[model samples]
Target: MSRRIRVPFVLLLLVVAAVAPVGGAAATGSSDAGTVDVAGTADLDGTADADVTPDTAAGIATNHGGTIVRTTTFSLTPGEPGSVDATMRFDLPDGVPELTVGPFPDGVTVVDEGGFDREGDRYVRRDHGRAALTLRFDLPSEQLSTADVGIDTGDWAYVRVPYVPTEWSYYGDAPAFRGDAAVDGEGAVQGEWAYLGATETTTRSAGDLTVRYVRAAGDPDAPSPDAVFAGWNWLATRLGSGGRDRVTVFALPTPDAMEWRRSPGLASDEDGAAYVFSRAPATGTEPAWFHEFVHLLQGPEPSEGMEWYPEASATYYARLAALNLGASEYGTFREASTVEEPRNVRFTRRSSWRSPTDYRQGALALGAIDATVGAASDGDRRLADAHRRLRDDDRLTYDSFRDAAVAAGNGSAGAEADRVVDAPARHEFVDDGLAYADHAPDRDLDGDGLDLATEREHGTNPFLADTDGDGLDDPAELDRGSDPLAATRDADGNDDGEGSADEPDPKTVDSDGDGLSDVRERELGTDRKRADTDHDGLADGEEVEGVTDPLDPDTDGDDLGDGEERESGTDPLAEDTDGDGLPDGHEVHVGTDPADPDTDGDGVPDGEQHREESESDGEDVPTWSPRGVGEMVGDLVEDALELPRMVADVVRLLT
Candidate 1:
């Protein structure tokens, strides 16, 4: 079975904090409920809203460099095996309008808000003054098994500490957590983070990047830390990003019962760290790593309004980077980007974290933007330039990103982006940029005269000389008034009217019912529609089967019918088969042996005899020689007399 689990940060927090019941619901015991309490003092000086400059527009905040020190503890009582108790304690800045905390994890029931009221998932603090607040909730312990937070399994405790952001701002640094964390009254010490689910923690440095791998004790099949570092370095180089100072990757065992958190999984934090869980070892070439690395390179989310860009960019670049690194092929990325998904909703309006369709649509839109940029700039710019600009920009928003793209590309690229990204419906764009990046437009794969780009433009197969598998090549078909798209045609070059039924393919079969197949006709340079290409007296089948030329009516040019020559047992190619002065046809008409040069044992040749007879009569008397005339006269005399003795004597004399 295969499962895909998307554990978005905001969603995870909501699930964690909202499990407590509102009123009078019995508190499920700690065993059944997984309780996590997070306490942190507000660093008001580092608030993103306070850090915003005058030039920043309303509702926009600046980056907050200061960190909040948070301590989150999970406690579960022994009574209920699956329940949990969760409490969140944090201080709000003085003069702030309101303090909001969660969109917490599900299965969390909010039982108490410490005098604060609930507005959506957050505990509303309307006092607008400096104060400490605590919100309590109950959640199912099973949820902890999937959550990146530490899990306590009685004998061992495992936890993934992620920087959970408060709901009030988008630009604050990830809160720092205490190294010494506890679960169920047992103290837990920080262990090195694993790389790709290895049993031991291994660290390696390459260039400016440092990578850490953490694995459980028994699993020894995880990838080596050095290998992981090398892979990361390769990716970084290809992506054109300087290496980060530190990147921690956790390789955890594949959760058995949690189908929601199966292998082939990757989730990253605001800090340059990731938790990758899979049934198999992690490789840098995997799409999971490529995707997460894209996130790392993108840094943190810059603004709430631009929530969709990071994931979208990550999804799009994962495939692109894979292609560049030779980890994937063009067809793979093309297929992924061009998949048909429902486009009823705008890509930006769709939830980036929860919906896969939004990612796909956004990737497709980015592909279109990239192609447009590359085309308009003549290779001067691409989608990566926009991403680089976005990474460097302090105030990031959709408009800012769009402007960056426009600056990198031309006006047409901006228009393309608007058409694909800002439109109400998602549109799929061609991946020609990726497909033909390394080739010229005129490169022909099948050696058909038409280039690949032209073939694509004309809706013909670039890999095939004849796209429809017709007897004619694509260029020939185009030149000779044939439809390259249709394989079947009638005698007049119209569709064969077979509709959906199985009919003979014109490319493979002789549609005109001619003796020659279509391929043979093409090879012979004969008319496929007409059996006798030269309009000869003989049928094409007879001419071909009899070793005669179908393109020429008289192959021998002997003034004799080829068929007649065959009947007379004479060579059709020879004018006179017997080397006689008379032609084979003339000899046959004259009732002389064509193979014999002389007849009646006469010293003169048959041709001489025929010529003498013709000259004597001043006409063409080929069979009227003196001997033949005397024999004919004697036969007439015998018949007239009807006298047996005289007829016998004349016949003997004539013989």
Candidate 2:
């Protein structure tokens, strides 16, 4: 397919750069539910009349941070095999106003303060006062025992925690010591603490999960799978963040897929596969992958707002990794090159076969920002340093990362922060005059074009061609042993053809992964690499809707292909197509086939060929043109010469 021209993020980036924020801030506020159910004490004196805004939760009292405080548990009561109450405690700041609380998620009812929101979710009573609010939502153990909660300050920050399904510890004490009876001959405590007791400590550990690549659907084979073990071990080790505690990975069969997650953002399943359809997955080795791993490790509290920063970090670092790996050289076609911008752009846009332009353009914009903005100081924008800091200090946030990036640029964090806050744009450094060809060596070493100033102003690359401006120099791709004409086909792939390359080669056949080569798909009109023709979700020989398969009876086996059914006019997948008692083809050959059932067994379908005959008309039919028949056979008559002399004389007269 022709590449789509990137609609130019330069404008968006530069505009964003002018007003980017100084620091990342969270929206504020929390909701309220009255009293501690277990204690039967009203934390709030009463409902105070006050308007609630996202900025702050009213009537809640807190002891510590000016924001709403939250805590988490590994398991709780509702999660128990047969419990009903799933509860969480919200410690509000002392001077907050009236606030309302509720049972989140669809279909839950709040028994105490009954009211429904526009979306039909339930909300409970409001509390006003100077103490902690203990809100409990009834959850049947049959449903999910655990649910996540968010304590939004409704202003600058929202605290979140996972509410497990078991009773929690209020005393903040260590687990009780267990008696150790079993001892070796040397007399040491044999079984130290068999089970972990109740506590609310966040453990930094590797996720416990496994994944495997299968050949196709219905293939029963498991081998060479990826598994996670040990506390944040290899993942952190690979990220170069030693001693890191937490890490998460959202694994999928491929990075450019759309169907994995229905929506954008991070999702952690029961088995710990954190599926993130929004962010682009890392492609390079070592440090680059580690850079992505860090983002997962951070588990940046999910918010629709803070999505951009993490992605910016990942893209920035990936470029750095490429630089470090000696894979990129900086210059021009014929000089040195640091980035394969076109490939980077192509892969980013087309990845997942969905949302092609948004991600790649966004990533490119960020890379440009890092390079140009970071260039003010002699390599100070220290993008790599920022990533290192993030991995080293797990608590580092978007604001902190931005600060590091600014420091590298020899700029004030406050100034850049304001820029970010005002405009969410990024800028790129480019010398537009020179055109770059596919696989062409970089030419401009000093980022200055010897070409015309107009070309430089336009940042135009003369070498870029093709009508739609897909950014590929069609002639160039063809020169480098690739098909320049077709959008899909290209050479350079494996025999199995299971994985598609960032670029596909077409000259050779066999794309379908079916042992057959491209020559076959061309002959059969099937995708050269894939054997399925007509795209009816089945291979050609297997089934064609209008065609039949002789080998398989029931022509269309309910479970068979159309080709199988088409061998005869009936659907192979179905027992019969016409609904006749007899099979289809039998009607054509079986003198009395049920396909055209008629009790009379007549040649016509009974009534169509009625037994009536036209009555003989009384009028005589005129017969003429004896001469026409005679003229036609006069030559034969002459050859036979059986006619008398008078006949011969008549024939001669006519001739």
Candidate 3:
């Protein structure tokens, strides 16, 4: 019985190149246009059944296994034509598996493939995996030159196999294989071909996958070739030289064709070719591009038991790349994944596996590893070095990866790796690592009390303490319920229903209408909304302009208000003006000039004369006239006697 296993969704979109068979060199001949021809065939049908074991039969038996033969010919001589021919033979030697073939290039004309139903760009052979057929097509030289393939039709072709490689364009695992070759009539020399072992072979996984691009003609919806190249270039630079050098990216016309859940659902070739199903531009901004590109930088997992590492690393780097390229902000990627998932499940445990949750948690684990490595090495090494070690090592396994990490960061990295890998779920250590990767520390770049990450999220300028140029800093603005992103307007512009008539907007100009702007109030350390900040009966603006302390009601401590002192032309900071003994306010209230000690020019001082009169009369008299007190008293008595007689005369007249 054929037992076909469902392919992993991510792997279906990946097309990895075949590692050359043991002792075989990769194809390395250059044509005038740098083009070469490649041909291969895989007979997955039961006719070539070698093993019915659980491992080999799972992919072939359950799924409708079929045979696929393909040939591609192109020139390296810049501006040359190329061609691709594929034959799909189907049958269910045991029973019909749902056999389908060829998401063939767009504009391909079918020639002599009998009894096959055409469905879009693909050829369908149903009710059996048993059949033989051939397909033929032509490729233009200009189309071949660009990095994008299938641009005309918005889809590319792929042959379904039991297991697909993560890289693009490699067909090494095809059941019965024919080597790569040059076209029959082309002047190109036949390139070398090798049948690398199946995906189960961990011994010979060192070599990189070869990539090629194909696209549909005149497809306006396709991403620009330049953008695709730039994105790849950025990814390559990030991964460093040890990463895969050659990759082919096929830009699909629509997103539907690239859906993971659909039929003919392969998004990548066994070789390092990718099928991008986005209608948006293929710039680095697209997270999907980064996600797939990261796969090329990943080395093979150490063992079947450790298969999650590759996927986890890919997931982690996708977000990292986006952040590095400024396509996304810090914490965005982690928030989406780690925030919702359970924190206590072992990532490697089968029962703990959840679609995106597991993926995100695994990424966190990798991030922790990266941080540990970086920290231990004092930034002298990084996670990339560990990956490079994995690529260079002959054995790929969890232990190998751990050893590499430990070596990269000395002994410290090993403990960190264990802490992440063995934990049931995420921990604070993981969060710290993720934060470290994001450069989230105690950094308040603007000294606004908000960290750089928060500043970025709130749209506040990290370099400027006051993002809006408001009188308040960003933190103060937040505390005051003001927008750090918007500048504080003048009083006339403030109508957001926050401040009342009595309390003007502190951020506005002349907030208190005291002739001082909010900026000036801040400079003078006065309340912006209160005309008399210190309740000294003087406007803050006037006090500030007059060089008096707005915060102090009694600037001179002379029993005089700042406003009264200013009105009297007395120094507000000094209690005595013009050597007067009386207080400034007291002198002004008594109708005496505070600036002059003796207004009448008497020999005695004004304060001394007043004191002597009070002592002599035994009364609290503020001032005494120059005439004698006896004359004053006589005038007072005469006025009183006259008032009584006048009253008696009025009473007699009334009677």
Residue 198 alpha-carbon offset, candidate 3, angstroms: 33
Worst 10 residues of 3 by lDDT: 195-204
For model 3, the superposed segments whose C-alpha errors exceed 4 Å read 1-85, 88-215, 238-245, 255-269, 280-286, 427-655
Which candidate gets the maximum TM-score versus the true structure?
1
Please name the candidate that would achieve the greatest lDDT relative to the true structure. 1
Per-candidate Cα lDDT values, in order, are 0.50, 0.30, 0.48
Query: What is candidate 3's lDDT per residue for 466-578, written digit by digit as tens?
Result: 75554667786667566564455534565323343222354455645899876666566554545886667888878777778887777787878887786778888878786
After superposition on all C-alphas, the RMSD of every candidate to the true structure, in Å, is 33.7, 30.9, 32.9
Tell me the TM-score of model 2. Answer: 0.28
* Candidate 1 lDDT for residue 395: 49
List TM-score per model, in order.
0.44, 0.28, 0.41
The predicted structure with the larger TM-score, 1 or 3, is 1
Candidates ranked, most accurate by lDDT first: 1, 3, 2
